[model samples]
Target: MADKRLAIVHVAYGAVGQRQNRRSLSFYFEPRSFNSHTHGRDSANKEPWTTRYGAQQDLGYTGPLSFSHFPYTRCLEDPSQLFDIAIIGFPFDTTTSYRPGARFGPFAIRSGSRRQHARGYTLTWGTSPYDLGAGLHDCGDVPLSAYDNAKAIDQMEAAYTTLLSRPVLGGTNEAYKSQTAAISLDGKEHPRIVTLGGDHTIVIHFDAHLDTWPPSGTTGQERITHGTFFAVAAEENLMTNTSIHAGIRCKMAGIQDVEHDDAVGFQVISTDDIDDYGINNIVKKIRQRIGNSPVYLSLDIDVVDPALAPATGTPETGGWTTREVKRIIRGLSGLNFVGADIVEVAPAYDSADVTGIAAADIVHDFLTMLQLAEPPVPHKGPFSLEDLKYP
Candidate 1:
């Protein structure tokens, strides 16, 4: 009787395996044919499979990795493919003084953006960047030499200049009509760039450090590390005096750093100013300083408190909160942003991708800032009265 029971169990298992095998064979050998519906054919008689059949969409976790999963294109190599806004990566970090992992910043930031999709919308901004009429594309990273800092800097500058020279692909929306004209420099409308930085040094202004240290004593090769690139930019006339630096809390060599920062054409906004002056006032100050001149906003990851965003080459202890930084960026929406970058996110130093997420969110804000034709009107909650009593 026991032998019969075991035999019965074996037969049951064998039958189940046979059924699975048959199902697998049927799936592989099933007759397949494409009909009009399957091929995306329509009554209008347009070419079948020519248009809607090949639509490419990516889920948050799956797809070719691009900034916000924007369609990848070699716009620099092929100028014929025009775009109003382009996301380019600068994967260079030899210039960084404190840390070396920022060279992987672009990849980390892109990975963090995996959650963002074309359909995603920001309630605060009230629009999806992809829905904006402007043509947006990921232009890939500018190839740079890791061994040569000077060569890399030149490559970056040249790449930026090339992109800046391209004509803007005007958007379809009426509100977006004026942006191209307003952001035009040299009497020609140019494409806006949102760069993924390898380090904080690539920025002209903003972050914990003033980043405007003069290269007085250093050799030509040593002159242009991440710490002093802004000074080099100032010398090269790459930045205007209207630029301003916010969230500065780095240990300065002396008062000369501030003086040099001023000379390099940046007004300083210290990290503590957020506590004293308030967020609205700080935004007002930034706008007042920038004044209508084409703005290039660059945010360093170290600008945020190290506790919240610790994956940066330089981590300053006391810095602005991520919320405060986002609020400030949101407030500055109406400014003419020609380009922007979020830099210095070293994933090796990150605990649980907090820094990378912050950087990606800021980049989302950057996109919104660039696409917005006007500053977003403040939201009034249901609890707010037309005339609320304040104690």
Candidate 2:
């Protein structure tokens, strides 16, 4: 009986060994058929995987960084890549008076815009900026020297001048093209620039303080801090006399600062004026002040109350709320805006990224403002029963 059991066990072991040997041989040398359809090689396939290598639709969390995830282009270096509107970054903060972190403002603003997409729609504007026919692209940041304020300022001015000189793409929509015609000071069709700033100094002087401080007698680097760049801009003829400032609440050295600000070609609208005159009135005043001239808008993040947007080089307590500022900006839609910048966003001081997010949303408004042929129609809320006439 023992001998018969041993023979059966040997036979079972031999059968298992034979099956294992066959499996190992098949693993190395099995003949397999390739499915052309699965590999994207089928001639009948209408859409091929190879053709979708550079799709613009991107998930917010992933992908290379750019404002609102617009296609990145070296438009400044290569003018052939045409664009009607370009977003550029100026990352220099050596000249700031109080805080020095605004050099990182552009990056912070871009990072905060991660959740925004070009195709995203805004209820307030009733349209998506990308839906408007405009060739918008991110021109990336202008290279600047960190150690030299004078050189940095020169670089910024040169970059702005170059971008302002570029011809518009005149997108497929004829109405938008016509609306943008002759918007430049030269009475020519020119691309609009939305600048992400290094400091408040680089704008048309929107902030809690009057940036048009009289140039100190001393020349060189001492001459061009963030507080005095508008004075430099005025000297360079970069700003028009029709320019204006809003949200002014800074402590001043008597009324001479106001006199100097006026001489620098900026009409002042104090922070308190918003409380007294209201948002619509402020927008009306700005629109009337700017008229049809090519307007360059410079907004300092400190324009908002410090409690709301504290990540700025200069913070004043009594300032406009982010909503108030956005409302005022939305109201200024029909104005001819050639260039604009939101500056002084130092994210190091930010809490939960409120300031960066505010700056990003403001840029979103900038895009909508640039692309709109006319001002957006205000929404009539559902609660407005006047529209519903009882039968």
Candidate 3:
């Protein structure tokens, strides 16, 4: 009986060894010699595939047509339409002071923002601008035909005036053709315009620089280059007296230029101020200055350090980091932001779309902050740092 049991054990062990030998031979199907480039689709197939003689090509197909694909929430085009916010692209960059190409800002920004709407919901704010009950729309770029600076400026202002109250398409309201009454939101009329830039110059009436100079050879409209739009905007009574300019790093003509800035109701904050007084204090001061008045937030891409944002025409050194600027802007939530803009994104100067991505994110934050007026959502519990890391 002992001899018979030993023979059976030996047979079982021999069978297991034969199975291991077969498993080892299986690697022959996937040779280690071939480079990835030379590896074809049939490399893993045991049976050889027949080669095709004709040229390999994919048949193209047409899809449904749409106006534009927005990175944020989108609405249908409606004339005389009142929404919480409207995105207007001002693609006229002919008036740049240092570098040109900001005319492409709106297009680049839109492209960058393509991924945002997918992740628009956030833990910090607990809601998105789309959920705030007010509607949002992307009014495509204003058809700015003028190459002349003054004519371009007039076109932008006229377009802005028309967009403020009426639809991008003509509306029925005769009174609202060039003027719009403020729409009520959160107990206040806060229908707003969020403009993508043609250049930093388009911020003319909106900031401290009225683009004034000390009488040079350039005369009349020529004098009003990109730097002087603010002066015209102020003269037109288009700007609110409580406006503020952030990230003013470039030199002015003199102290008088600054005086003119203050004279036109702008409280300027330089990138240097962020280092002097912390971001929180700067934000507090901004909130104090802006108060409950309707506000227009303008962000120039050059405001960021060139190391982080090198795509703008005017590359300034020692500027704010993207994180710092975002924190400052985010801190100003709950303020009545009636209009805003992210300007000076020249993609031709940009490498790897860094400037475009930053511009898109800034606009995303602006949109997010617009909805932060409501109460915060309760935290669910602890999440690890690794859990929140980017993909």
Candidate 4:
């Protein structure tokens, strides 16, 4: 039954929706197949996603599920049924003040990731992504049209609501319930989720899903935030359980109304904290706040110090560096990372794919981290930074 289930997974692999299907040049995520998206279709030993961590491989023995098969948007199919991770695109950039191409981010990321997603890599967590057998899905975009800001927000809210509902494909077997529903019903597990972004605002939508996390009243936890996203999520009541962002920036003046409860616990990783303790100390502080919660990490490319990733719509100057990010993520292996997304990678800004490549490598790092085993072994020091050595 398990083998049959696994085999059918390939055929069942599909995207959930289409973000930019237009004219005759439209592109939608479907079950992977040979196509132009693959930069090295003919290579005999093509390995999809890779970084210094190791080569990319799914938990099972199937070959890499290319970008062709990635970010599945066809709702009729289910990528989550097979792979555990997804490389999402959030092309919405309205809320951002800096760049507009972020609205076109999903497309650019797809273009850059074509070959990588198709191939995938293995991680140094001493495990294969395939061995754990993760699933993949391209949920298309958040459907923002004509720029009716309120309407766009509504659609975004609806999209994430559906995602968290744990929609089920056509099946009524004993485990037929959607993965999330199954977890809620039978005490089984649901797939973890990692969303890409149209902008940092997309994190607000996920609030409805993760806000009630840690089964409520669990224990200590921090809150997550960055300038605009911080305020928006705070209002939405989402950052609470995540135990992210230790400080609420002064720039976020009026926005704190988003999710402000007196007992909201967890401090925002404040500017003062960073000023006093430095990023390294802040990183450890974040981990301590969360203790052990299945995390859904969302990296707005802006988090990478402006010096590193300037192409983003919101480039905060004093953000963490690539070196700092490597240190933090390396320390974050064991926590149950449900899913992740690297939002706001606008390629139209700077030099040759600098931000795009950076974003790609970050996503690669995320996947490798996910490839770690169940009871996670402790991470001693920085991971083999070699995986990210390339562009």
When 1 and 4 are scored with TM-score, the better candidate is 1
Candidate 2 residue-wise lDDT, 29-109, digit = tens: 433332222354333234545674546556776788898888898766886866888899988888777877987889889
TM-score of each: 0.82, 0.80, 0.66, 0.57
- lDDT for predicted candidate 3 compared with the true structure: 0.62
Clash count of each predicted structure: 0, 0, 6, 65
Q: Which of the predicted structures, 1 or 4, would earn the higher lDDT when compared with the native?
A: 1
- Candidate 2 residues lying further than 4 Å off, grouped into runs, are 1-57, 185-187, 200-205, 217-221, 237-239, 385-391
lDDT by residue (tens digit), candidate 3, 1-391: 1221111123455577787664434434434442244456335533433353344422221121111234232222344455556788888777666788888888888767666654677775666655554456676777776557667777777866665644333333222222223323334233467788775411212222334342232255355555665655677676667777776777665788878777666777777788899887888878878776656577777778888888887676878898888777778776655567878788898888888878888887777666565234444667777888998
Among the numbered candidates, top TM-score falls to 1
Which segments of candidate 4 are over 4 A away from where they belong? 1-73, 76-83, 115-131, 167-188, 201-242, 246-283, 371-391
TM-score: the better of candidates 1 and 3: 1
* Candidate 1 all-Cα RMSD: 7.9
RMSD after Cα superposition, model 2 = 10.0
Q: What are the RMSD figures for all models against the true structure?
A: 7.9, 10.0, 15.0, 15.8
Report the Cα lDDT for residue 122, model 2: 75
Among all windows of ten consecutive residues in candidate 2, which has the lowest summed lDDT?
Answer: 1-10
**Model 3, which residues run further than 4 Å from truth?**
1-68, 71-83, 167-190, 200-221, 374-391
lDDT of each: 0.77, 0.78, 0.62, 0.49
